[model samples]
Target: MEELICMDRSQRLFEDSRKVLVGGVNSPVRAMKPYPFFVERAEGCRLYDADGRSYIDYCLGYGPLILGHANPAVVDAVAAQLEKGTLYGAPTELEIDFARKIAKHVPSAEMVRFVNTGTEATMGAIRLARGVTGKNRFVKFEGAFHGAHDYVLVKAGSGATTQGVPNSAGIPADTTKNTILAPFNDEEAIERIVEEEDDLACIILEPIIGNIGCVMPKPGYLRFLRKITKEHEVLLIFDEVITGFRLGLGGAQGYYGVKPDITTLGKILGGGLPIGCIASTRDVMEHMAPVGEVYQAGTFNGNPLSMTAGLAAIGELERPGVYEALEKTGGYMRKGLRDISEDLGIDTRVYGVASMYQMYFTGEEVTDYQSALRADKELFLRYQQELLKKGVFLPPSQYECNFISTAHREEDIERTLVEMESALRTVL
Candidate 1:
């Protein structure tokens, strides 16, 4: 067995935190077994914990730090914005600049409305869809997490799945009754739902299901959705919070060559800051606010800091070879992990695309949430802990996808593979 890394300071902090914080962490997924390590600071692709232990971070702040932590461009932009002011509750030129950039890159973003988080972005998108179509029902795939909103919590992935509560207790039955759940990669299920439910407002989904350990869409699946949703007179909304800039500047919509009626972007769009946006065609977006009756507003929406950071972060992404480099590294990592599992004769399924990946302990392919649920969660957690001992930090959940950043160099990837192999050996 590998010797556990010392986390005495972090252990003490967790004890103190538990008295005041829920589950000793703000987010449920941060609740790692044997207590989570409290990060003191992060730079590039590494996290320095309270115990002074450094780890190569694949969590990447849950998919926001694509350019990596404490990026100079983002830091400088935010710093400059701080000198000017923080929040104005009023419009700024920076917001316009950021929105313009989003429209330039994202295929579906001709107009935009900024919000505070991915949750807010999705909530607004769903509401807008309902208002536009004057319909009550919407379709979401099983184990696909849009956010922690009441409407989409029925079969959520991420922390909800990790905590063994896909359906939370507080939500009323009426809220979820209208939410129809379908299995991913299944066209027949969607066809039935569309035919049966006459008042369907929209079909919202993550193009690549990142919440359920990065499941890719089957061939023609996205195109199938675009066609069917159009035929049914239902709007198509793409929740690209994780995949927005992570896949490429165009996000999953561009990568798959299928555009949606509405797109929700967060995470990387904020550049490690709090930001989310619901974007669509000018005609659709005009339906929001003073322009139209679908009301959505926030004090922090289009706040200067997030706008500045987003602009700067995206500007960096606009540089040549960024996506190519990320693709190459991602491919390398996936191949290496698959090879290690094969070499060890371990029963595992490696899944990923671009800079996202995960290894399910089950031998079968993970094409949907049901298959993903069959993977040995306890075994995956054991492997995660083992990797932590070797200075590698994953998200600490089998259901959450691991990420790679531009800050991750060749040496980082090589060392991670070595550690991963050792961790797999120790656990399996």
Candidate 2:
């Protein structure tokens, strides 16, 4: 395995890096079996490794690069803003602009506060919910990731779920004891839990789950959730870090036509920069700091670089027909992959909504994490290696979603399909 030419350099890097970095990678999922390939550069939909091998990148930084790498607009915006300044503890107009832009694009958004990561956004939202409702307990779904925070880390101890005990060693049991867990698509579990736990302050979910592969809420599941949360005096929060601009200008809420009381956005919000935000109605948002009690602050909360990149990225996403193009591209990819698997007699199921899709290497419906776990991991591993060999790069983790950027054209799409056919043949 180490002798493989295409992956040898990556394997070497992992070995060298392990002495200094945990698992030889900054992030766990990036620690693939053959070691993660160290990217030298990326352009459009392609990534070039240190070994000088180019591959069509499907990981897209785990669903953030909806516009692809170094998009001229986003890059130029970040670069230009850097000349002005990097960070200032003081607030800037760019902050207001970005917030206004986000609120304008997302209907459910009336007021917004910026943070540095998705974890922070969710953390802030949870506190705000507790502050606003005067309740402590909350409801979270199984296998839905809300960043590496403590409270939302229940049943989610998947990627960073240290020991698969909901909360890691550092987090006391009391933190998650109130954090009730329910399976995705099981509204009954949620309703029953809400009925039992009258103190439940909020209910948060990914809407279209991406942590454990892309799983859409079944039928009126979201509507039912919204109803339950509202009826129970609980705030419904949508963790849209992945779904944000990737689904549409309004994210999953707009895509599904259901509104959550609060939405935490990350990934695409700052183009490729690290940023996250929590947006809610005026009444709900006012509960933070100056206006109320709950406090959330960051020195780089609205750094100029991220603000500019976000402005450009959101502008592009808000462009008319942008989502339509995404729908077409995502649909094409889903069909192409399904056809390839069927031709190779490989069992597979594609689940997701809008531009997001998940491919499970089993001929069964994957509605939740339990069902997704039934997939053929060995086949997925072989598929990953085969695709990499064919100059295509996908997220190594079977539990993550690979994205399709607008930069992908018919030609790029066709090449991916060709590689898929060849890779499927090799794996099967």
Candidate 3:
């Protein structure tokens, strides 16, 4: 790998930013060692840093850029909407059209309400669950990040059945008291928790665990969850913020053939813009404000600009062979990574659904968070640095999933594989 030049401009910018902004970044993950690179602009699958270093961005704006950065259709749509207005603080025909599109694609999204972000979507879903069921307690899998809200901030204790410990500061103990934690892909543990816990409102999780290196659910695991949730009369909520439009227009529920009572979507739905939605059957959705007593409102929710972008994005996804192309591209990358690891005698597992992947430096099958932790962080860090120097960019953290966008061409994957092979050789 070639020696990389110093990000002098980015370093100076970070220094100046630290004087005003906390940790010199809005998001904590952006505070990388030696200062994270500041982006000057991004188009398609590439990102240009402040220091003029261009990287093949697999981060894809943390998985929202499914159609890739500055997609022409989406850009044009938003630009057109901008001429009309940005926000009305009221309803528009575009919102109705967007919601209908969501309902048409997502199996469980019979009715939909747009929100601003994934955090807001999950938080609102939780409130709806509690209100409808008249139950305070809810169940979430360990390592499954629904959002950064008080209820979801609790971490699993020593055991799966035990109450969660508050993982973040400023979160009240009482707020998370009803938040039960269980292991991902462990059907027995979830069943046990649901059976024992009284007045449980919902079982919420990402169908495919995206937080801990894209750990997939075991076969029949989601089906089991759906059955148990139904039998127990608990609302099953699939937090498809990452999987929603990416998995397919139908999301994970459509792919796995397990319909949840409610689904929260973000990421690809916004076409790289800020947006989110909580969808459910009319029976449950009727309970939310203007129709029922359960109150939920957002000033910027369903804003026109986001609505226009989302329409264009979903429209693009509706085109034939879009997902098929993603699968082919993702498979090419996955196979190349695995073959390289095998050739180098490295214990790496490249795993994920189509268009999303993560490589864990462990030979063992990663079924849950505990198993995922076995990945070698030190080796991953070194490999990541080497890959960056070779002009390939991955997510800074090993725990995060690497995304592939429609913008990634054949040559991009081939180039990435070459850099990855070199990076692995260095680490080994």
lDDT, residue 311, model 3: 96
Q: Which ten residues in a row have the lowest lDDT in candidate 1?
A: 1-10
Candidate 1 stretches with Cα past 4 Å from truth are 1-7
Worst ten in a row by lDDT for model 3? 157-166
Reference-based TM-score of each model: 0.98, 0.95, 0.95
RMSD of each: 2.5, 2.3, 3.8
For each candidate, what is the lDDT?
A: 0.94, 0.84, 0.86
Instruction: Encode model 3's per-residue lDDT on 1-428: one tens digit a residue.
Output: 12233437888788889999997988665666667888999899999988799999998987899988899999999899999999897789999999899989899988998999998999999999988999989888777777767888765211111112327778778887888888888877987988898889999999988877788988999999999999999999999999998888898899899999999999899998899899999999999998987888999999998899999999999999999999899999999999998899988888987899999899899888778777786788788888888878887767778999999999999999999998888878
Q: Can you write out model 1's per-residue Cα lDDT over 208-240, one digit (the tens) per residue?
A: 999989899999999999999999999999999
Question: For model 1, what is the error of residue 73's alpha carbon versus the real structure, in angstroms, after optimal superposition?
Answer: 0.9
